[model samples]
Target: MADSKERLASSLLELKKYQEQNNTGVVRGSSTLGRTHLQRLVENGWLEPVMKGWYIPSSPEDVGTTSVWYANYWNFIVEYCNSRYGDDWSLTAEESLTIHSGNMVVPTQIVIRSTKATNNVVELKYGHSLLEISTSPASEVAFDPIYGIRLYGIAEALMFSSPNYFKSDPVNARANLASLENSAQIIRLASVNGNSSRVGRIIGALKNIGRDNIADEVLKFMQRLGYDIRVEDPFDNIVKVSASQSPYVSRIRLLWEKMRGQILSMNLNLSRIDLKDKDSVLRSMETNYVKDAYHSLSIEGYRVTESLIERVRSGAWNPDAEDTDRRNALAARGYYQAFMRLQKSMATCLEGDKFDLESELNEWHYELFDPCVQAGIISPADLIGYRTMQVYIKGSKHTPLPVNAVNSSIGALCEMIEEEKDGFIKAVLGHFFFVYIHPYMDGNGRTARFLMNMLLCSSGYSWIVVPVERRNEYMQSL
Candidate 1:
């Protein structure tokens, strides 16, 4: 037993050194220490197989979850392609446009162009695959400076993407179109290989998004180049473009604009409560406290029970007790605290008191994690603002925006919620986009639920409690 432990320790030390030296998670078989170290790491779950000879860094906690694979998807693609093709490959034009529009959701299948002869599909973990198109000319190729993945330039992506792509994903298409400062790149690309129909769609898309000046410039330039292009609008609807130039902000605004219509169309039978009758809602909330707390915490993977929720809510929870140090107990207490705080905010909203939307939501977040901070489970600094590090959703392909994008994106989201007139639209889109941005490191779901219920209660709709049994269905809907 002692000898086996010692050997495993040495192997771990060697693996640590290798990871530190390489400065990346992607590892190839030939680059690993010997068969013994590699075998040991795999058995202990320190490394996970990506394919036959390749591996990625992981932990035992990631055994059944796709988080590690999804988090490192782009990084592994970069390393694998660079090693196999030596700068001879780039992402497809449609894929490049998707990323260029700041839609970082992990794609189902990534198509690549390579100078190599064979066209093949390489299967990856968790149903993700790569479609390799053979012997294609890799023009307009550029590397993403941050992730090092090869892709097409924004202008080329716009010009080469299919006409139907503009209609299918208008948010991504519109955001990319709005990113252009001038028609210079489009005109340059169009002059050489001008397809009249394709160029016409580009002009129509630009004009659809309130970019008439650029549209006029492109039209005139194409006509001067002797292209008989006729204008055509590909989009089914014209959306008011957001004023902000930041792609992240633009993307969030577009998502809200697209979803708000659907939300309005829903047949939600909201029961109208009188504005002055805040007491009845408070009484009902107190009655459902245990059920609400139990389901909300349990859905978040907390080992919470109705009795534990009751103990916390009844003020029998002892902060200094050793039993209370358990994470589940700490979580129950925190949920209770945050629940109480939300009630107070809901009261103000029901009474029609003017409040700053951002400040109210921040207070809810602070209360949600304050118990964990007191227990030293997390730093108090974490509660000060938006998450400072990147966070991933378990078993999800949707990668939240980066740390730099969170602050401004969240600000834009709050402004939309405040300006929205319909309560259902506010509640539905508020919850959907909040989780989409994932502003906080932890408790994003819980915070989003609180936001949803707050809007619902203030607007005379009943408070909603998502049961733990429906956790899977609820998450999938998100």
Candidate 2:
């Protein structure tokens, strides 16, 4: 019995070694030993039965299974592909992007290209499917050293990917692209000849990068090769080239010109305010808050007063109270609450030595909610009710800018401000971009005024608040 137990333990160790070497659990050993040995291991909780004749080594941590088990599903596919096709497996363009970006936002249907004719969709655990489409693999498609899988060329990747995915938002797309470490790889792929049409589309698709020259070069090359082209520049209206054109190249050329201008006009600069002395800056921020809030509220036609703030904080106004005065009082209270929320959020964010404006804004939302609820400005029921109303009424509309998005957007704006040599453009665009993002749900106008004052203060310019009389012009400029 001791020798038999030793033999079983040896077999389990061998199975674990095999799985680790292959990065997969499926292993075919001697048939007689395999079935019985696997069953014993399963009974002993030393292995998990994934499928008939397929088992994975299990530990105490594997007791509560989750969707993360599906991650190993890719390893299974890789092993199966290698066994069947022998080192000829590759992911499709979209799948490659999903893997490259480490984005687990899995799509229901994953498109793949292969020399073999396969129409069958292999269903994965948790309703994911890998749809293998038949196509000739590009010559440039090669194994990524880091990921250990075949990847599509950048040009082919951009071209084959759905345009809607890239067009979700220019700012986010640009940020993602900029975050990529190997942008030159894409540029190299774009330089290829057969992919000119796709290259043109990608150039037009890129919202944030200054790639007009590259697009022009691509256009000229394609035109010389007798390919009809038209560009669709979606970034701005100033480029004079209309999307309406007969040939594709004509539209593409116009778009390229316009995109070039927009990209060039974009500011990319570091913030002027020194983040090192955060304490002193925060003290100054509190001082500026009083002045800015007063002016901002005055411009918004609110008779803002210290007494009004105190009343709001002390629960004199009930957001849900049926009385008309209660409603008015709540509105007044909301104004002060919003300002204080912004101030508190800013203070928390600036409290630490490091700058994390986004985190500060996110924290502010949770922190502000309790105070407003406690003060009777908003009931607990109103929170859910308002959120539901917002979803139905503004479902198709854009989300009102939250503080985190605003702060991140501001970080981008500050990048632009520092890069542009001209001070006038910096000042105007700085204010324009901040308000354009509309960070807060109700206090955007006030916040925009506050941001503008911050910029003005930094630049030695007088902090100018738009008067209530000039609200129309102020909004129009924004």
Task: Name the 10 consecutive residues with the lowest summed lDDT in model 2.
Answer: 388-397
What does candidate 2's lDDT look like per residue over 1-478, in tens digits? 5586896787688676776776667543336246677666667666665544444455545543633334344445555455555555577765565443323233555555677737677665455566777675545665543224566644455556655555543332332333333334445555554564565565575422554544566566666766676665544322222221121222223323334457457764534556456555556655654455455666655665556555665666456655654444544555556556655554544453354433433333334354457666666554321122211101112222322233344454555555656444455555655445544444445545545554444443444656666766765554
Error of 1 at 154 (Å): 2.2
Instruction: Report the error of model 1 at residue 117, Å.
Output: 5.7
lDDT of each: 0.83, 0.50
Best by lDDT: 1
Q: Cα lDDT for residue 155, model 1?
A: 78
The reply for model 1, stretches above 4 Å from the true place, is: 135-146, 191-196, 223-228, 320-325
Q: After superposition, how far is residue 49 of candidate 2 from its true place, in Å?
A: 4.2
Per-residue accuracy of model 1 over 413-466 as CA lDDT, tens digit each: 899998999987899899998999898889999999989988887887777899
